[model samples]
Target: MSTLAPPLRTSWHLKLAVLSASLLFLIILATAFAQPAMRQNVQPYLLDLARTNPDNTVSVIVQKNSKDDASLEKEVNRLGGVVTKDLHIINAFAAELPAGQAVNLSTYPGIKWVSYDAPVQKSLLGGLICTDCVSTTLLSNDYDYSINANKVWNNANNSGAWLQGQNVGVAVVDSGVTNNLDLYSKNALLRSRLVAQVKVNTRASNAYDNFGHGTLVSGIIAGNGTLSLGGYIGVAPQANIIGVKVADDQGLASESDVVSGLQWVNDNRDKYNIKVVNLSMNSTQAQSYLVDPLDAACEILWFNKVTVVVSAGNNGADGKPAVFAPANDPFVITVGATNTYDTATPTDDTIAPFSAFGKDETGGVKPDIVAPGINLISTKPGLAVKLALDHPDHLLEANINYMRVAGTSFAAPQVTAAAALLLQSEPNLTPDQVKYRLKATALAKKAKGSWDTRASLKAYDPATMGAGYLDIYAAVTQKKITDSANQGVPVSKLLWSGDSPVNWSSVNWSSVNWSSVNWSSVNWSSVNWSSVNWSSVNWSGDYWGD
Candidate 1:
């Protein structure tokens, strides 16, 4: 101790002060790092765009806090935004905004996030409010009776009330919607229930179905009995149809064009009362839902309270097909196809061999439900629309205006129509709520039969049948369901940057690791698929076209 006396006697107070200073430095450093993490609102793509060619303009979808649409548009204008499409449903805007401005937009007041217009990247840390929250069914023949749409319209409880989806609009975002007699408005106040029509991806003059797919999709959702005299009444016949043409005369469209079409739909949804969007198309790309632009688009739509319905693709029972884009997205309802075998019961029904199944790249199961796809007939243009021209034999001898088509494309609109009916029945239901109700009420196909026979149940495989087959009657009339469909679920955009899929258990759902992301990995290039880029390689080119 005597020898150590020379070694400057360090006091306990000095040690305490050193420790305190170290902690204070750490706290300040952490605060500096934490601030940006708190607002990881700029999409990686927008960041890249800002870094490279900052002056270049690209269409981006922006999510902001500002409630005023006019003011928001003005802000966008101030930032050199052009062709700005108000996607108010998601509290966003689709504009050709300058790259630098789009990236820096996150710092602006009310600006939450900004991403390339493929779909989007929305902040995970906010409460949702449906921007324009406004919110049934019957059918005939194989799907009509099979899906129980007929019973829904003429049900004993709903009897004369006729829940035919009054005022609800189903936007058919496809080739275009040809005006058929069945699609005409029966009301005196309105000229047509085909509420809005606009050309999306094409230079076509009008948004009428020269390609035929949109009309068929629309008819499946809301065709009346003008031609068949109630014999071929559609599901939710009284529902409004908002036709958006994203394809050319040859039934081809670019993904950008399709996105623009959706932009149009979102902009005008309030005007047309469009709540349900029927995307009867599939993406050819196998990109993870985490990065797929289409997935981004559908996600924003779902958040904005629009019920998005997509086809599961026609890749067939392959080696676990990566369920195509919007369909692979967990938020929207993805539909698969089932062959009714010309019967009205599920005992004889089998999953269509050509219908795509999935365990998406993100490990999410796909095709939320199945519906009649094989030999399903709906409104087709009498003139040589692409589908009709491609398969002349499918034209019904009884009615040339109706054509039988098969694929998940036809199956998606059925669910869209059901959603319309559900909205009509319960106007205040959110998209997540709608998803929950549809899934909760959907009857699980029994091991030996449908829900009609309360027998031994089958182990559900979400890849094949999703929750179960579409049962519109049960979905509409079921007890009130309040749970959110996405509760404790993984969102597509929050994926980890590495090759490995995100471990949802360990992730902080409220924050994003923006630094690790490389948005250049996202493929926005458009290549000719011999048809529309929205159609899958095997889907529209071969199987779906059949």
Candidate 2:
């Protein structure tokens, strides 16, 4: 309901070093704090935030070690910091303090970690991240055969009406959603399937698809295509939606905006029967899920029984080492883009050239699943919307308006629809079960396909593709089983949740291994922490914060 403000104590000192002037970065590396028993609790990025802000006002989410959130609030209040939110779900609270005092706050005896509220935006190509730069690679508009959405849609109940994801709600945390005909409710009393519309970004005029990307993402998940006359239906036509706007009209957003949006989802999940959350965007940086504040926010929702789906970034062809957060976080189902080539068969599907590939911060092959992202068509608000205006070539309108856009940003919604469909059928599958089923039943990308042609026992690459392409039919029909995907994974909160010995401070902090997130992969020389310059990265509603 309010901005993040918390108490701060400027008692501790943590030095910020620019390891490589050639590369923009601010990392503690824990070399200075590696004394007798001091644990590096404050994230280095927060220090950078304090140093670069013109106003010197920094916001953060502080995680506590043992005591309740109230005690932590009192401590923050004593330090003259503003206590913004009491994040009970993750044993943490959001607060705003003086920029340079984050390390002092981290020194609190009970505090576990302090994370910077960084900026998050759309998951477009790394350098080419602009509304106008993203090319409209429209191949064809066929969802039924491409991802087998038709099979799931065809299965009807005894009542004669098929289970087109009826009533199961998905929270679209993006720019905004338009109340177009495709999203209108089947019931006469309801205005649209969007059961709720909340705006985290108060700067925005209203919660509508002025940016246009949110409308497209919303349509991909549950658009009925009432305007297209069955020509372009979404994965779950009958599924309801909840629009949570985190970005402004121009599609720019901060990580705090997203965290607030996720908080809204957590608070209202049961009220709207919200089962899935579609995050087709990511943060502007790539930090380990263990310390990344955004990961904690998304994990809170996943723990509260909301299945979170995220898109891998568009850094595939660029040779980047990892995907951005919360996609880099393993708890949620992270999806990548695949060029379906307008074909039903899986033999020809290849990970989109621009679709993000390679390992995440944890060194695990990212994109738990893949879906058609290139040249995909979905509902558009209008030609005046930001995305449509930025790339008019993407607007392929008939009697009803639709836009063709490409990137992992668009790919993730297909899986969100699949998650909704599965939840609609069973209504009891946990987030872990949903993730396990999707990865287990996915169509493994084969080498017999026309491209790589390399012979091997396993057709898919364990380093990049993870499981494989999306098969909604197989995923939804899988045996309803319960299992945990993050059994040995780091909890992300406790001091040194994942101790790599090789990474971090070299002063082993925790017992958990954090799976195998090779922190060494992060290039210290290339990270840019200076005031996140967005003059070039015009993320058109793909707010995937790192």
Candidate 3:
């Protein structure tokens, strides 16, 4: 009995020692893994800027590990930073701090990351040629038929309902959308279609479009052709507009204003049923989409189910890579411009000379789709009428409140309006699904005579045209089932990765064979541009150009 007791006691002692060792091993492993989390929370640019100007106060985004406001405020105070605003929606705070102090805040226990609030400028180019056509007549333009928008409106489904983009809301985040006579009328349906207009900038008391850009974009999306008497209708005439005025009177907007506008849209998505957002402007500063704050803000909105459409910029003539921020981001639909040549048939369509194109910084193919933007006549601001009339050579047609304009800015809204029609047909479709559907159903560019021969000595490339022109009827009526779960980078992975100050160098490059985008089947030499009328061609306009 004594021997048995000794053995039992020894066995219990050995079990206790093994349990303690196992617990100690787990503690060591956890500590080793967690040590990397304390290294640095500030982006490299912020650090460099701080070193150069330690005392300069700059706006920053502060992400905290704790949710308690008091704790966050205390931390900010301790770090010599002033809390400018609390963005609780993103679990972060907007603070203004001395550059050096802001960088130091990254060392705090509860801090996650500190990012400089980058500035975002509007990208617009002004160039136009007046069409000699009479104002009293209704001309059939090529863009509507080029994209097949007219067919979508005329076709009847099993339910006898035409895809007119009813009940869908598209948020235009840009210069204020004015109450143009073409946009708003005595018709209750038209009046209510403007839905909600919010001024995000404190500098403006009213939400009127002082800069003519936003009104034109809105008119292109949902203007009900009241002024033209159904001759110049927009792509989705019945879709509602949720105008988010981020840009000021000078057509300038900062990153914060855009972010605030996006946040408001996210919060009020249900109130307005905003399923699509048209970002017709581009940032001058180019950055990797993985680390760009504007791209991050756009991704958040996209993940929440808002279809974001951005202009690919009008920087094509500069010889620099034209794709720039938020458009450079893969998640959003980056649109380029195609000249429909003011005709209904797409046989003469060509890639716009001024429209930007290229692979994004992350190597993603951009300008996911192209649309008719050259000499588009849409609703213009009250002030632009005199400007258009003064420059008769640039005016295509000037009605009481409408003017003709051209830019990649105008091209983006065409896709946005089409997205509204798609959502109206399938409200449950995810943002990824919408993107895939548009790309899959697009009309392949004709290899011959598809581009202006005078501007280029070589053949047209797919890099400029993406998946070709926007095909609204094909995108809406086709019954193809797609699972976009694996396409591009998932927004969820970007949002929840917890890898703040994203190391862009480490991003896994897409293995997609970009060479596969080449169009070798068509004869390029047979194309002749001499048949196209050069006099009526509007070369006077450029998109987002200097």
Candidate 4:
């Protein structure tokens, strides 16, 4: 309810990079310190209230008082502006401000803390080493990269044949970065299409990335080879990466900034033929409004035939039900976390202790699926830069450089990279089709009926793991039209929570030859492939006799 003072005269595009995962981004405080009421002589941080068409205003959420919200709203109204969005607790976009301004934002009333919006840069150096035979060790060191290589070598149409001339494009909408030789050597990282870049301050420019999160995320998705754990590599080693630096070095981003990034991708999705978008950031608050800017952007991407993957969040059991904004949005593919190599135990695919869960205020399951996010390793920015400088291929093993970190953020790019490979295999699949194939064909990491207890092998629960673990080979091979669920095969009863409905409005029995079947007791007449309600329907029965 904070009132905003208007008429700063600078109306730059406000891009708010909202969070979907925890490990992939740097966050910043949204609101900066404004004129402090009842306190004179104390300089307050200034909040940038970017006016979007007067009716919609994106405010940089800073530390402020609840009582002051109303006053702030009044102040904004005075300037012909409205307080459209104020995410008080989760400020991932605040990283764009200068250090002094960022400090002022942290001290405002009721402000717990402000995180800077950091960008995710690509690991160019890693790419250079891996593609060359001399840099084979670059793919050996990291476990996550090993897993990715395994998935790709086994499923990507037999040893990288499908990747020929594809040059799959991925958008890393986090931090800005410069082109380097490591990525250039293997032709893995593409810097040519810098569709757009925005910075809060003109001094640093969009290329500035202090937090180094964006570079890391991009490297995970497409780092060809600069260095290896011993010899590790990214998932889509040959894919082209587009760095969208929405967050500043501090890792903070405003809501508008996030929306602006999405809009940019949506407009340019066709130009680059960008297949997938990986968001590793998260928002603390679950947006209640249907027309939320983040959600709207997701829907736009979905309609434009672009796959959007988001992190479930890192707010598990901290306070409220583990839910994050944009991640919770229905249109976006929400990913949760699981441990790598724990399939034998019930803990396998169980939501990571730090990973967020999905349930609305009314209690509904969230996070459509979970991937390996815990203790996962991937590329780093500084290391990539180092690799480029040394040109590891030309240097000795001692000259190689790379980095590793773990989080749900690290896990998200795996799926994003997988989607890119899937797109390569099935170039005609729509975004929704890709999502369904991902869920439908995912191999169960654990057995059935396994709960909280960490057994050797257990079943994946919809409440926690959702449709099970990611299986690239099966997903690429699985036929959507022949899927048992789509074929009207029998699926067992399942217990689901949330707003899922049981009734169908349209059904296609062509796959089953059920045109002559009775319509009285069966729900065969109203199954809509486009809007299949997963929560309300169970596919377990389809496999029993199929």
| Candidate 4 structure quality by residue, lDDT tens digits, 238-312 | 666767766655455655566567767766777777889887776554454243445545645654567888777
Off by over 4 Å in 1: 1-140, 155-159, 186-190, 317-319, 445-462, 490-546
Candidate 3 lDDT score at position 262:
80
TM-score of each model, paired residue for residue? 0.64, 0.63, 0.62, 0.55
Better of 1 and 4 by lDDT: 1
* Most TM-score-accurate candidate: 1
Clashing pairs in 1: 65-110, 119-297, 136-420, 136-421
lDDT of 3: 0.66
The root-mean-square deviation over C-alpha atoms between each candidate and the true structure, in angstroms, is: 28.4, 27.0, 28.2, 23.5
Please give the lDDT score at residue 457 for candidate 4.
Answer: 22
Point out where model 4 deviates above 4 Å.
Answer: 1-138, 141-149, 154-160, 163-165, 178-182, 185-204, 317-320, 341-350, 360-364, 383-400, 445-459, 480-546
Give the range of the ten consecutive residues with the poorest summed lDDT in model 1.
130-139
Q: Rate the local accuracy (lDDT) of all candidates.
A: 0.66, 0.66, 0.66, 0.48
Per-residue lDDT value at 108 in model 1: 54
Clashing residue pairs in all predictions, respectively, total 4, 25, 8, 110
